[model samples]
Target: MGTEFLNIKDSVDAKNLIQEYFNKYYEPEGEEIPIEDSNGRVVFEDIYAKIDFPPFDRALKDGFAIKSEDSFGASEENPKVLKVIDALEAGSYSKKTVENGLAVEISTGSPLPEGADSVLMFEYSLKNGDEVELYTSVTPTQDVGKKGSDVKEGNLLIKKGTVLSASKIGVLAAQGFTTVKVYKKPNISIISTGNELTELGEELKPSKIYDVNSYMIKNAAESIGASGTIKGIVKDDYNQLKSKILECLEEYDILICSGGTSAGVGDVLKHVLDEIGEVKLHGIAVQPGKPTILGVIGEKLVIGLPGNPVSSLVIFNVFVAPAIRSLLGLKESSLKKVEGKLTKRIHSAIGREQYQLVKYDDGKVEPIFKDSGAIFSLARADGYVNVSKNTELVEEGEIVEVNLFN
Candidate 1:
């Protein structure tokens, strides 16, 4: 008898869907030159140290190099005197060999002489005639830094797909890398849809709102070091929406259309994506964003986010943010999610995941307005709290992880 495969629908969580969608698409990747150019770019290659840091052993102090045994038992009460056979300046290499009871004068960063194993501070000893007196005892390897102490040659510095930072550049430079290779930055495109919307500078008519999605989304793209181009506003017509998205998709790796995912406005944006390519997932069981659409547009990406500013940003933070990071080839972002106490109880229905927009103040989180459409509420927010479907209605004083915007 043949067994039937169990069709487990809804078993795949948001994470699983995210992973499945991620595995299907290979983001745009390329190589870039220069250290600063690699800042937002992802590491395409594992970077190894070509040479050891501090390549050579040098004097750690502007003092005299001497044998450790020569300064043994020397103290402030009774000082030991050794002849300063020769003096070496900074950047100079000392060839003199310090035998027993002999000291070689050396400056900071100067290479240690052939036989010297320690250095004595200038303050502890006085130089008179041709010799210097040491008042302190010295230990083996005292005041001497060893080569490769900071880093070793051939050691892995940064793995591929790691976004290089300022300090990362310093490490590469230390490894003698004047030029570093990294993935090229992705080009982002932003478009807003709504017949009742006008541009920012235009006069706001009574029932119509100005186009805020384009500016806001473009700013978000710029924040991540992404190059953004506003494709202007597309009327809530399916044909126009289709034409605009398809046209902009050609010039950008990621195309974003905001405000038309809802059912009321004919959902021209959502339909455009479906007609062009397969919509991976239509509705997410999440709050602040339910009509979210994630789809593949040929080799590019087209996302249909909610029209509400707060809802759109919430979805961006939850889903699109990681996608952007993946596209940039950045390492796992070090964005810390902080836990804060809830100021009041929040009731949410069981079934859909909820991302509550809350303002953190004095170690507490306060929910925003009833709806996530309020833009001003979002502006004042610090982060969000993710409430699972099965577990809703958080009591006051309960601690929750808050994703800080900063």
Candidate 2:
């Protein structure tokens, strides 16, 4: 087993380095999925409108559809009276055409009657028997949605690599798409190491802790549309850990193991991966999670995260999460963030980058101080502020951006 920590990279440098590898070697595969099941997935191809939005000229409000010239010179005192030939509601089409002194009553979203050039609101028209009296004049296309006004046929509605959200799904549905082509989600296998770790629902022995990192990382991957599995726990034995990882690498695109990553005597995850595959990086210059390992065996990527629960989750968020997103063909620029004022001062070392867990309240944030092993440490945190490696102190009342967990 290799005990030396060589080629330790800066946090940001490590992410870019890993991302370049994925971009060069990994090509995202696509699958057709029902539009209802596409939310949170990435669109594999550009989606163009099959038909013009609205499909036809439609009424924007409940009104009388008429030729604009017919309502010209009309006033409340001396109104222009037109015979109502037909009435149409939403989803209903009118066969009757507005010609000469004839008009059609139309509801919002109803296709405009043939030959009608404009609509006069009901407030500006009085209905008596079959006649509608227009009290005000209207211009062409006034209160009327023209055909292809919203979106034109063959126009790009969604670009390739766009994340499928509820609104994006609605756009696809509006175009009569029942299914869409989307990038396949990556399969990630998680293994928690350390003999001191106990499975949930098992008896808690002295000096033993419940497994938390595995579940946390699994859910995090799931949130980003990756399929994740917990492969149980492995004691600090090299052979057991190596075999499990080797087996998982055959079936999974990414393997993540929490614990046994730090350079302690018992830390064997890095050594095992190094022996079987290649360890690209064994450590990062980041606080609380400096002992992260990035490696590759064949085409599969393996990550060894810190044993501490908080550190594991934080490192996963900063590095592993983005990598998973990249596997799904998502861009890192899509990460959402918001700026807030820090309620208190935050101090960090000058060399290593730091991510301070914080609680956000009404645009103000305060650091969450908890031990790494505390179960509620992350639960109480709403987000984190990434303090760069070059800076030392973020003074109180300073504005900083937070990347929310959600």
Candidate 3:
């Protein structure tokens, strides 16, 4: 056997380890779906606009669209005078055109009359007998939102692989897109294995506890723009777990297993992966989620997350979610993050990079626990503070960027 590196490197190494496996198996599969239900789904192709967003020159503020030169150098002392030829309200297209020395009374978002070059705010003008007087100087293109200014015709509005959100939906609507082609939600099967596990939403019986990691990670999958289903629980029996995982492997683009990823006895996930395909990675240099497994099952991406709820969520959020995006169709912008300050001291074991849950209040982040069962840690956290591998402790008042879960 070739010599092996005993020490796990860092988070980058951990990410790169799984990324290589994801690159091969998570390539986009063909699918078509509707735009309404496509929220959170990845775009399969570039979205082109057939027309501009506004589609016309519209007034931004409640003002009168007038020729810019008409109000040139108008002031309180010497006000410019022009006729108010027509009034336009929001949602109404202007039919009357502004003649020389004329102004068109326009409301917010109302289309500008032809020959109008600028808008005079309502506060800056006074109307008297079919004429308006401007009390303030106005520059060219002052208040007119020009046609095709927001987005032009034939412009690329959204690129392929962008996870659709409310803003994206609005953009699509502006482009007159009724339906769009998107990558179908990659059906994911999550199998939790361990004799110590009980079904979620069930009362615990004897030594078995609730399958906390299953739902925690499954919910994380949905939160970060992916669809996943719990394939239920299985005891630490090799054949039983293998059969169930095989069934899940056939239909799902991604397979996630919890509880049996470690090297301990009855660690069935490693064996099931070894039986069907190669185990690409065994361990990572990360606290709580060190026992992360990345591999391929047929042409699908498979991840065996550590059974701890926090561990499962950490691995799934930082690693698995990105893989789902990269393999399917999405960009890094979909993931949300914000920088924060550490309010308290935090210590970590050497060699393993740690993602510590932190609550931010008053410009400070309070440290959360590394224990796997601290679901409250995730719930209350503003985001996570990264623990560098070289550092053993993070001091208070240290500025650290946090990647928010929400």
Candidate 4:
């Protein structure tokens, strides 16, 4: 039996329904992983500093460490002279203390001497043998970095649910953390279904095309921190397709099948979902990807996307990517976008949201109109423009928001 198209859902409502169902039943779990492998992963718990950063009063400049009282009122006109007592490099400490007429030569990051309270920059001081003349007055604690001033012990470092960046990794290293707790990546299974699909290494036949959706979808999943594997292709056979999907659901958190989602006689993905599990959504009011399917089987989410490369990618970016992020407790706006002006007018179906592939030029976006099934449709474009379902025509020179594919 053909699936119903009379009740195709609005794209926004469909996404909301998926999110609500996910929040009700799914809870993301966490695991401890090495910091080296934790980049881009969401933090599972709050992290705190175990010890104070710097851990000691350090020098902020390469100059002389001295008592501010001795350098007080000193200037270029009448320089103050002091004997060098000792020299301290970075990671070294001084045993001798600075007296009234003595100074300690200190390098940046060197611990402040016992009796020295300020650092005099080398530019402001002149050295002749062991005696130095200070030409500028320095206040107490000037150019001195105090311990615990930057990061105090037991202070919160990274808050829960924050995405770990390279800078955050450095912060964890400062806290002496070799490993961190992060949300576990969702495991996904991708199956490309079509009688006209062939493997990459196989010789091309007139009627068959290489399976691009499987590999493309796999990388798309990986982009969102989800581990995806191609579970091979399933031809247009109801029994075999149903068996493979059921088997995949047993081992994966999400099952994604490309093709066979339309209302044609050969499109049996929706029927298979109905037979084995729940078909939550049959179609969406979207251009190029109106034949999308969203369902659930057992505890796993099952999604069927169109066979066309451009349509498959658009649907995954709009639906699957966000769903994967939500399962991992990540924000929906994780992907960044830019806004630009349209170079020309574009038309869209009044009742369906349209995504047109476009190239961004000096602040102007030029739409790329090509066959959806052609690989060059998206290859020549930098990003895509979203036109609302109610928007029938977009005029030239209009400011439009562009969603980059990267």
Candidate 5:
């Protein structure tokens, strides 16, 4: 008997099912890695500042460090002259304090000497033998970077579940952190199934096409911080497909397969999944991706994507990406959405939600209508617009929301 979809689920219900199932089985663990490798990883715990930034009062400009009161009445016409006791460059300290009539020549980033509360820029002062003339007055703490000003001690620097960026890594470096605790990335095994598919770098046969889904899906997973491993291609054979999946499940946290998921006689993925584990859902109520399959072997997720390259990626962005993000303790749907008016009218299946690929430019959204198998259609699209399942036709000039690709 040919396999058939027993109960098809709408897009919303399907997503909810995948999320709920994964959340129940998977919990991300934390790992300590060097700060150099922490970028793009989620923080496993809150990080706090142990000490004040700057740690001491430092000069912000190259000039003389003096007691502010000494320059209170100084001006260009009648400059105040003070004995230059010592010179302090960046990374150096002055032993002598700035007494009532004394000044210390300090460079930028040098710690301020005791009793010196302000810095006078070199432009406003003239250096002579043993003395410097100050032409401008300075207030207390002027040009002085105070301790704890940038970051106070015990302040929460990075919150748990925050994704680390380049600047965040710099902050950790500033705190003298050699390593950080981050949520471990999920390991995914990607498999492509089709007799007519050939691997890249191999000679193309008469009717075989090079595999696209494995590489595309791998990069897509990596873009979202998951570790994807391409398990190469497997022909449409029941025993071979089942054996490959079983092997992947033994090592990977998730398994993603492309093709052989429809109701056709040769589409044996559903049957293999049924025999090995459980086929949770066989079909989705979405145009171009209705043959998608969701299954599980124990705690490992096995997803069967449509053979069409465009459909495989679209369904991935819709369902698999979010599920992976959830496992990593990240908020799903990070893609930005913008409002735009359609350039022309379009038709969609009445009962199945449609993800109409479009080229969005300057508030004008032009729909790129092509078959699901057309890879160029996805390449030409900047994003996609979701048409509701209840709606059949969208009139021209109608404003719609476009979800921009990352």
Candidate 6:
């Protein structure tokens, strides 16, 4: 064992360093993709409505289009009668206009004919021969979908940097958009380092474990809209690690590696980073992830996570996830958090910020304290609560914010 970290930074300072570096160098470009594939993608530019929704006045129900005055004083006892001039269905326009005492039979979504200001629903009118007897009165525009009522022309529909959802895509489809301009997804390469790690599905040799960090970290990046490619596992050999990282940097926007980040005889990731690129940060003052590393090579960013599975994911969520989101032009505040009361008291290292894993259930948060290397700790946890460095203990029944994994 060796003292690997000489100078450690607080978690807040570490986050600021990442933000400052990415803000200066990373500027994502936009690409046009089919609208059907735009969901969950970030918008590169503001999208405006080119035309009005409903383009023209249309019927909101299967009914008759008529002047509102023509239905005045209409009731079950004393009904008003109007001659049906023409019948209109959706996508068809009627050239005929409604005059006084005249109505046009209209189907739902059909464009309202000229000289009509209201629609009488079929339930309120009885068709007798070519005339409809109205049993109820209506006001102008009643049961009528007016032009530009839902969306007006030239209105800003989607703002830049907004993530497209199903509803937003529907709005674009309504405007006849077959494709949309979205920020290109950032490509990230995920690597796991350790001689004790073996590839999944391979026969597990004695004293070796299957590689978990590569698959775990890859999915985490992809969940946030970045394209992830797993580069498999690398041993503790410095030259091999350096060659792999350099190759990945040539093509990927970011490279993330887990394991072999701590200061030990077998930990060679720091030495490789020092020779190939500038190490911006060597350690962070956070529990379960103090040996986290951040670096930059050329224009691409590099991150090293702890060997411990729990520590690796916690640091990724706190530090790497935001960087990925920034490069994709998405909001950094995407993690969902909820408030809950602690089920029991908890203690932490006074000088280090602690991310205490907890199982949140119906506003109650129960601490799940397991060793950092324990992968099951993360599986049992719904989220974690950030305990400040200055605070050493949190009493039971105290309220805290839990950052959810999903």
* Candidate number achieving the greatest lDDT relative to the actual structure: 5
* Local distance difference test, candidate 1: 0.77
Worst 10 residues of 2 by lDDT: 368-377
Error of 1 at 168 (Å): 3.6
RMSD of 2: 2.5
lDDT of 3 by residue, 1-406 (tens): 1123234546788787777777765566646666676777778888888998678888889988888888878998899999887888788877788877888888999888888888889898888989888999778788878899988888888988777888898888778778888875667888888899878668888877787777777787777556789889988887898798778887777889887877677677777777888777778888878888876777776788888778888788887788776755666675666666787889988877888888877667788864776666677877677887788998888888777777
User: What TM-score do all the candidates reach, one by one?
Assistant: 0.86, 0.90, 0.75, 0.93, 0.97, 0.96
Query: Which tens-of-lDDT digit does each residue in 1-406 have in candidate 5?
Result: 2788859999999999988878877897889999999888999999999889978999999999999999988999999999999999888998897899999999999999999999999999999999999999999999999988899989999999999999999999988999999989999999999999999999998999999999999998998889999999999899999999999999999999999999998788999999999999889999878999999898888999999998998899887788888877788645578999999898998999999889999999999989999988878898888999999999989999998766
Q: Which ten residues in a row have the lowest lDDT in candidate 6?
A: 1-10
Q: What does candidate 2's lDDT look like per residue over 194-303, in tens digits?
A: 98999999999999999999999999999888999999999999999999999998888889999998878888988888789988888899877889988888887888
Candidate 1 residue 328 C-alpha distance from true site, Å = 4.0
Predicted structure 6, TM vs. truth:
0.96
Cα lDDT of model 6 by residue, 250-304, tens digit: 8888899998788898998888888888899999999979998888888778889
Candidate of highest TM-score: 5
Q: List pairs with backbone clashes in candidate 4.
A: none
Q: Which tens-of-lDDT digit does each residue in 1-406 have in candidate 1? A: 1111122123135446655665566555666587755555567788888988778877899888998999988888899999998899987886778988888888998888878888998988989988988999889888898788877898888998676778888787767777777666668788888887898888999989888778887887766656789989888888888888888887777788888776563566656666788677666767878777767878777887888888888777677766666666653456657778898888887877788888988777887755776777867888888887788689999998888766
Model 3 bad stretches (over 4 Å): 1-11, 29-45, 52-151, 159-168, 181-184, 328-344, 373-383
Clashing pairs in 6: none
**Local distance difference test, each candidate:** 0.77, 0.89, 0.79, 0.89, 0.92, 0.90
Clashing pairs in 1: 43-161
In model 6, what lDDT does residue 291 have? 94
Per-candidate Cα RMSD to the true structure, in Å, reads: 5.3, 2.5, 5.1, 2.0, 1.3, 1.6
